[model samples]
Target: MQECLGFYAWQGNWERLFGASFPQTTDQAGVAPLLSRVPVVWFSFDEAGNMTTQNAYANRPKGWEKMVDACRGRGIAVDMTVAYLDGPKLEKILADDSITDRIIAGIEREVALFDGVNIDLEGLGSKSVHQADSRTLVRYNFNRFLNKLRDRLQRLNKRLYVCVHPLNGWFLGYDYREIARLSDGLVVMAYHYGPTPEPYEPVEQSVTLALASGVPQEKLILGILTLKPYEIPETLAEKVGIAQKHRIGGIALWKISFLNEDFQAVLRRLLQIK
Candidate 1:
């Protein structure tokens, strides 16, 4: 099967464009080469849970439209990423039916403008809810929200993508199998295990946990961080080999802003992009 490669780009990381000589210019040509290699790109223009706001996309940075258009022009899917907001606010939002509907509707409006939506909610059960009943309630509410969102996306014919952070202390909250079944795919964040040193054990454990939780290999996209202390070419190759060996969905890099020419070339070769 063909592999799917994705890249995540944050709106705040506009230093390159803002510092460039011609900030007004769209510079589609500058990004075309990188866009050509990835099948999916998730853009975060708003803050966590900001999708519920009316002007969520109003403050989109310069060249945002041009970049999204370029991705679409190449048959690539652009997904709007929304992170989770912790605290009582998140609990209240998930528990309240009316609030949940409003949030989902707001998200749908944004999804209409993009190819899909990516939910990057993290730290599900990290809060101090000691009682077992309270924990169960929290999990139920979260799952309910996901189910409602999935159904709404299906009705709108939009893809639902979610990110599964590595199995750490925060793993108890999420039900990976349920999440996998409710969405198009899961981006398994396999990096950031420690102050990197080319460790593959974390990646392996993540994949194993995801599979054991009933997430099919085809729906699991291994995520790699491209920031400094980057993986050596050999380690990168090993990760790609692992994905290929397991017939996983594909691989995704954490951010495009940190990718350099040398690393990009390595990705192009590993991902088999022409």
Candidate 2:
């Protein structure tokens, strides 16, 4: 079984994944031994890696360059998240044509430093964070934003990948079919199956649903949960095997920052299992 190690660089803490294993200096060569065989995609959280509330992406973080440079030096692929908001602030920003244009321009500017872009516009249709009446507006704005992004990246001949959750009543803002058509690939966030004792959609189930959704299996990247918020007996290796047997384009572990040495070793074993 072959699997790609996905690094979610949340909170500027890539080192957290391996703890002491990460050297004090990212400058050392031949780091990330796990990446030797498979392609790695880095998922930098949008809105400054914050989860409690949506915030505008601020200035580039301090260690951004070293991380990017190190990964590229190792022949790893990288991608960052583009966050969008649907509120008074967003309305104001959109109202100003210059602001919208500048924001898009800024996105293009930032992506130049990496291999691709990952659009992570969460709270699109989630009433828990957004108003119900604004769902349609949010949906429209989200798609329009993606269209503009796709168009811009097309001009540069770059890839645009989207990471979105499974279609739920709470997040109807995203239409997977159209999204799949517009972007180079779709990363179905198969986890976050909240509260269900047995996850509503396990790894195998997510693969089945993704294939049935008209997303070319090869273009669909499975988001495997490296850290479970809840207790689940199965190990990460088991899930990797399931995904490998299904033969997805690849499986992207939800994060690098959350894995321990044991977890990473498991990841390495899984990657070489075939």
Candidate 3:
């Protein structure tokens, strides 16, 4: 069966069937259906990869364990997602081995409360690392970084996954082949074309390109943004069809905090289709 993942964001106050919440509830009776459909919940810790000096234990949001238990109670695997979008800063961290070592150490510490860690370090591959050139070196070093981080997480028996930009997109820092080999899976963020009613061809092309780059379909997870204004059930199902057509490993919703009845309805039907 293809996996279905829902990203549980920490930034939003969600309105649920029980009521709106500041500390959103995932284990509620109303949310059980959505949580049950999702095999995994990617907890957005709002942490960074470039920040090497961090205390993961002390940094958790209040009542983090209970929140995690809520999802785990439903038999869902909860993984932590660490993100860094600053291009220059990420490039610098990738260029220097010492910097990456610290970053990896910091990430390893953060995963103790998680089943796995998904690194979302953006702004590389197509961009320069130390200078205005050398995109190849950026990919080389990133591959090395993933290799090291994967080893560290493996020692802890925690899975390693990378949230990557689409291969057809502008950013080229991710070496899909090497990353596929290093990480357990690749969550391809395949949305954001321009306006509402985004094109699905790009999503299809991204999956195709990833496969062409030698990434196995089983290791690919198509990441779709469910918060878009035009993302109705019809549009959402089209994206799911792309993943189904390609036989990818699974699909990841950008977040579950914004999940309304409409989005949940689409997922219920779409996920069952596969």
Candidate 4:
């Protein structure tokens, strides 16, 4: 299968990006200059309230239709992200069936705007303390929500995708087995490993977990981060290359803003050498 590339960006920056193809407002355009060329784009937005103080793409941006149209002209696919974490509001919403319906309905409406939906439910409730006991509950409820969401998307002939972070205390509540079974494919956010107490290849961790979860290798999409503060030290970089040799599936970068020349070049070399 041909591997895929995806770029994450706020919806508002669409115009500035079009500048790379400046002076040409046509359907085919822009600075798609980067390693592992992205053919799909993922956009995250806050719903119902301002979840993040940082401004996100306004629910929908003007001219996105034209922009997506332009991308589709180049054979690119566009997808949207929906995040639901455990919190007081989530607790209240899940406790009340009617409330959950209303909230999910709203999410479905937002999801309908794109070709598919990517669910990012990391950092929900406390995971460290109840990782073992809460794992099944979290997975069960998550799957329930997806089943409902899937029904809604099916009516619109839309696809569903899931974004999973690498093993982190925050996501200990997640049951990878059930999640992989429910999701169409997994977008493993595998780049945070190298930024911790001891740096390591995030993709390598993802590969191990993905295989352990019994998630089909073809259904796994290795995720990379354009962000920095990373120290590869020659040895680990070579190990990373060996990990990528497995060719599990596609690859996607976290955000476009985090990418720099040096980072991009390293990724290019990895992909080329792989």
Top lDDT model: 3
TM-score order, best first, reads 3, 1, 4, 2
In angstroms, the error of model 2 at 66 is 1.3
Model with the higher TM-score, candidate 1 or 3: 3
Model 1 regions lying over 4 Å from their true place: 1-5, 11-59, 85-89, 127-134, 230-232
**Over the stretch 168-263, how does candidate 4's per-residue lDDT look in tens digits?**
424554556666776666777665554432245455766777778788777777665544454233432443353467666566655554544455
Per residue, candidate 3 scores C-alpha lDDT tens digits across 1-274 of 2567776554341343223464555334334444422322332222243442123311235555665676666676777776667666677777787777877877776678778877777778653333335777878888988899899998999887788888777787778999999988888988787577768788889989999999988989988888767466788889888889989988877776666777777776776521
How does model 1 fare in lDDT? 0.63
Instruction: Tell me the whole-model lDDT of each prediction, alpha carbons only.
Output: 0.63, 0.58, 0.70, 0.54
Off by over 4 Å in 3: 13-60, 127-133
Query: Number of clashing residue pairs in every model?
Result: 0, 2, 3, 1
Worst 10-residue stretch by lDDT in candidate 1?
36-45
| TM-scores, each model vs. reference | 0.79, 0.73, 0.84, 0.73
RMSD of each: 4.5, 5.4, 4.3, 4.8
User: Better model by lDDT, 2 or 4?
Assistant: 2
For residues 8-33, write the lDDT of model 1, one tens digit per residue.
44443333222233333244323334
lDDT of 3: 0.70
Model 2: per-residue Cα lDDT over 91-129, one tens digit each:
444445455566667667666776777766554566566
Give the better candidate number (2 or 4) by TM-score. 4
Q: In angstroms, give how far residue 71 of model 1 lies from its true place.
A: 1.1
* Candidate 4 wrongly placed segments (more than 4 Å): 11-60, 84-96, 194-198, 201-203, 231-243, 267-274
